[model samples]
Target chain A: MALKLPFLQVDVFTNTPFKGNPVAVINCMNIDESLLSDKQLQAIANWTNLSETTFLFKPTTDGCDYKLRIFTPMCELPFAGHPTIGSCKAFLQFTGQKTAKSLKQECKSGIVNLTISSEGKISFKAPRADIEEIPQDVINEYRKILQIDCVAAPKLLDVGPIWVVYLTSDAESCYNANPDFAQMAIINNKYGHGGIILAGKKPGSSQDYEMRAFVPADGVQEDPVCGSGSIALIRYLQDLHNFTETTEVNITQGGRLTRQGEIFCQIKGNADGAFSYISGGNATIVIEGSINI
Target chain B: MALKLPFLQVDVFTNTPFKGNPVAVINCMNIDESLLSDKQLQAIANWTNLSETTFLFKPTTDGCDYKLRIFTPMCELPFAGHPTIGSCKAFLQFTGQKTAKSLKQECKSGIVNLTISSEGKISFKAPRADIEEIPQDVINEYRKILQIDCVAAPKLLDVGPIWVVYLTSDAESCYNANPDFAQMAIINNKYGHGGIILAGKKPGSSQDYEMRAFVPADGVQEDPVCGSGSIALIRYLQDLHNFTETTEVNITQGGRLTRQGEIFCQIKGNADGAFSYISGGNATIVIEGSINI
Candidate 1:
């Protein structure tokens, strides 16, 4: 006999279906946690073949509305951005818990705060990122592999997932980059980096910037739309521009991949430090069904 | 407004779920074909992110039960093995057309014949393969990249998707092969081959052979269970051993990946030539639901 569990596939960072990053969310609200072992979760994630799959469980700690466990195809993740928003949206719709203005999710990384707008938009404060400069020789190798000239020196940002950030002269350059994914994977593995992020400013366009993420090390040649990559970019921009006040920008991604991923990002500078917030429209549940395991 | 369509995720080549290759099947039997354009089909395939996603429509040709369109994440395929088996099972279950012992599917490559056993096993005659010996220089390059010495000369088999077949010394060698997928992709792209297949015989085991497929060019690092590769292997075996009579063998694959994929293969040689058949158990529908498109 098989155990049937409710499942939802949600598209995050965009309201339109098939245009944003997709996450598979399994609703395990009242199911026995022991029944779903780590191996089974990993198997489900691998079966979905998505960038991320999340399991929603009843919270063990007080005050937290739910517990979230995230897994990529290869390994489990302590936290991830798109799965966070996608799972929350799926949970709200599944349980019809619409009265709450905010929710707290407990995971391996601890409690994460989420705010919901009247229009159903969701926003979460990004974990603070640690930044470091890239060496000249590695920068040269990246330039050769990607075949692009950088406008500013590249930096490494660790925001849960580490990103090698590159700033090009214009949006066209960012779109035109053709990095050798195999070489990128080797470099990423050697440096213990998550992937590479390419971004350029669009002064006259509706979106402030255009971004692309290449994560071959994680088995994804290119992410359709990335959440943590967006946060890492925000942190990189704040450091490069030396911002003093709160700043907000709209970033367009996945355009090259025939997807229109619109992401809203804000960074607030305080006496302590700067905190980044990533907000996106409500996720659209594209596939609703049940999985028997 | 979103159109809700029936969708199922089926695990092929195995009776159990999550142990074989998975295919996303959409039941579009009565829906308007014009509503789902080529772009939409490709987008849906990309969204599913599976090795293959098949759309089932009313047959356009006479004497055919249904029309099938197969698409991988990157592009549409004229024909494929696993998708053919998975889609047939899905169509039979969705429409409850189990009374028929055989069915015909019209695809881009032409009509395919599928026979169903009383116990629900599905078998299909593999496409006639064209075999050619691989050059020694290229074989040497493969040896360097894969870090394995072949016991027998490799031959390229074109059974719809071309496979570079290498016969290793033993089953353990097949399981221990660690090929450089990036380098393999480059070589495969240059040679216009689908991927590399490593196989070895097990004289005393339940299964006669063990196989592994690496298809980095198709964006899959290693296919858990490959149907065409299995067919190609059968063809190669028949040629190497000069089998004058009908031969049947059981193959075990995906063991290295922690998956138990059992494939039943048969080859019949006549004055005309040799024809191969690949059979597997009834597909297990792991995920069933509807997709709003």
Candidate 2:
């Protein structure tokens, strides 16, 4: 028997098409669960070959609107930023529910809240992180890889994925820095995560900071516009730079790799209490069709 | 204007639906050149996220049947193995030309000859390689990376894409060898290519050897079933061991990363003169649709 799964290729974080990060959203609401296996889901993800391809299914939780399983070509992710936003956009469009204000998405990471505006802009509250100190060995490795001595101490921040955050004084250096990926992967593997975010103040621009995310551990060298990375950066800023509850920041990423993307985020609450990060972005649907599997 | 491009996702080098390598083929024969640019082509490739996506166009060469442009999520390739075979299968099926015995494909690497049989097995002559000696520094790096003191001296073989070939005495070691991708990428960049292949003798099976191809430089950590890689292996075997002309060898690859795939090949002509390596495999069409982009 053949199954027709609705597929959407959505570009998230930018209003322009082909300018931001792209994700493949497969809606399997009507398809039988028996037809799709973990291997099959992984196969579909591998077929799309995207950084993340999310499969949407009916949520088992009482308050959750839908459940999303995100997969890279290699493995499954508990939660991902662009896939969450992209899947929300796709679910709204596919279900013809245009006026919904908020959505609770169920994933391996748990149900997360997503707010949608009438203008089609989507935002999700970033999960709180378990902050930790960067190991000295990791610091020494990055120092040699980045060729910089005058930099903030590296902090390992875990929101969903662990991101080793490095703050550079020079945005230009942040843009130009080429960390040896082999060494970077070693550090990432040592921590059992797949990413590192380098952020620096990008003064005098529309965006507040310039960032680049490298996830060689996950087979993605550089993420164009990372939503989760943005959240981690916001959390890092709150701890180090003292961002306020109402502080809204615009960050630009993926410039060096030429995908030039912008991410808008707001940090809420204080450092002592429950801090929530709201990441907002625009998504453009590039392909709408049914995938036969 | 809405453009309709014929799309086919074919699994090459295997007869199964989800195994082997999957390539998305976009037939742009009827679409005007103005409707698509290099950027659009890249966007489509990125959308598919497959190891490679191919665009089929009218051949610029006089005797060639068609021209193919191959793209990964990151960049375009002059020519690729699975795409060549998969595109041939898609084009033959789409154009209702199953009776044809042979086809000439034109790509940036120039025209290549492909043969098809009534049994539906597809084979193409592998391009000759420009062989070079392995640098001592690179060999040392791999020695440390693989954690093995004994490995055959690496040979840089440039077919369509350059592949660094390393032979191991133990097939288990070949399967278990995990080199640092970042270091591999550095070596690839230093050599201006994006692949490293590990090959070793298989004790007893239809396959003579076990191989794995890693192209992290192209964002592919491990290629499931690599056709170009098979050709390079054939060349390596002929040189390292005296596999004679008319030697038919079956090889299995991608066992470690779990997508166990097989490739069949034959070495033609004498070792001294022009030698052609023919790579043969099966393909299954998984998706057929008209894409509007």
Candidate 3:
């Protein structure tokens, strides 16, 4: 006998279908007796071939509505931003929970709070990032590999996933700049970094900046649109630009890949110091079906 | 209004689910108007993120039962072996064509004939390959990059997709061999080849050989199991071993990736000279659903 499980393919970071990063969402909440093992989950993720696949389960802890497990094609993640937002939308649609304005999700990284806006957008407060300055020599090596003129010193941001970030001179440079991914992978592996992000200001454009992320270590030469990478960029701005007041920032990524992935970010300053929030419009369920195992 | 299309995710080259290369098959035969443009098909393939995605349509030419279009995440392919077999299984299952023993498929590469065995395995006669010997210097460079001892001279086999192939000392070497994919990509791009294959004899094992394929140029560091690569290996054996009689060869790939992908090859010698056929067991449909566009 085959066990049929509900599955969804959701495009995240953009409401328009096929314009943003896609995540596979498997609803395991209905399966009461047989929970899928880690190996089975990994295999399903691998089969989907998506950057991330998330499994939704009934919450085990108090005050949480659901529990989520995120997995990439290669490995499982403690938490991932796009998967969180995408899976939340999928859960709501699957269970017809349209009236819920907010929800708590329990995962390996702890509980994450999500707020649904009047426009149906989803926002999650980013985990506090630990910052580290890149050494001058390493920065020089990166400059050589990326072949770009940096406007500011580079930094490493660890917000669950580590990103080595660079602020380039302008948006055109971000569009034109191509780095040696093999060398970048070597450096990432050497420093145990998750990926690298290049961002440049686009003052005149609709978006505040243009961002490109390369994660060769993760077997993705270029991520179409990266949610965690966007959060890391926000942290970099807060650290360098002195974001003392509540401010909203708009970012556009995946331009070179011919994808328009829009990310909305907010920085809030309070007595507890500055915090970042990553928000995106509603996810579009491109494929809705079931998988048999 | 959204248009809903049938979609199936099929695992090819193996009867067991999640043990072989997976292809996404979209059935477009029912759509009578507003045919999907190349851009839309490409977008769906990119969204799937699978190594290959195929669309099935009504036959455009006479004597053809169905038309197929194959696309990778990045680009379209004129022909691909796994997608052919996988899509055939999907089309049959979708249309409930249980009594058919053979079928003709029309594609950009022209017509291909597929035969179904009594046991339900699918086999396709491989296109004739044009072989070229590798230069000694280039072979040395590849030796350095792959860090393996070759038992025979390397060759480039072009059977629709070009494969730079090598015969290694033994099966263990094939399992242990790791090449610099970046360098391999550079070489492949320079030579305009599709990918590289490494095969080693496993005389005592159930299979005749173990094969590993690396296609960094195609953005795949390692293909779990490659159907075209298996055909190229059979061609190499025929060229070297003078296989004048009909012979069956069994190959196992994806062992290092913890997947067991078995390929069955047959070499037939006749008045028209030697020809190769690639066959595999029935494909397993892992996911069946509908996609809205």
The prediction achieving the highest DockQ against the true structure is 1
lDDT on C-alpha atoms for all candidate structures:
0.86, 0.80, 0.85
For model 2, name the residue pairs that clash.
A49-B49, A182-B182
Interface RMSD per candidate: 0.8, 2.7, 1.1
User: Model 1: residues >4 Å from true position, as ranges?
Assistant: A205-207, A269-276, B205-207, B269-276
Off by over 4 Å in 3: A32-34, A205-207, A270-276, B32-34, B205-207, B270-276
Give the TM-score of each candidate. 0.95, 0.85, 0.95
lDDT of 1 by residue, A37-80 (tens): 89999988987899899999999999999999999988899888
Task: Write the residue-wise lDDT of candidate 3 on A111-163 in tens digits.
Answer: 99898988888888775567899999989988998998899999999988999
How many collisions per candidate? 0, 2, 0
For residues B1-293, write the lDDT of model 2, one tens digit per residue.
Answer: 54667778788887766667889888887766667889888977765668888999888789888889999877899888989999999999788886998999998877889999888888998756667788798777767755654456778888888888888876777887777865676667776865888887777753487888988766666788899888888887677666544788788876665565778888887657766788888887866765656
Q: Comparing 2 and 3 by DockQ, which wins?
A: 3
Instruction: List clashing residue pairs in candidate 1.
Output: none
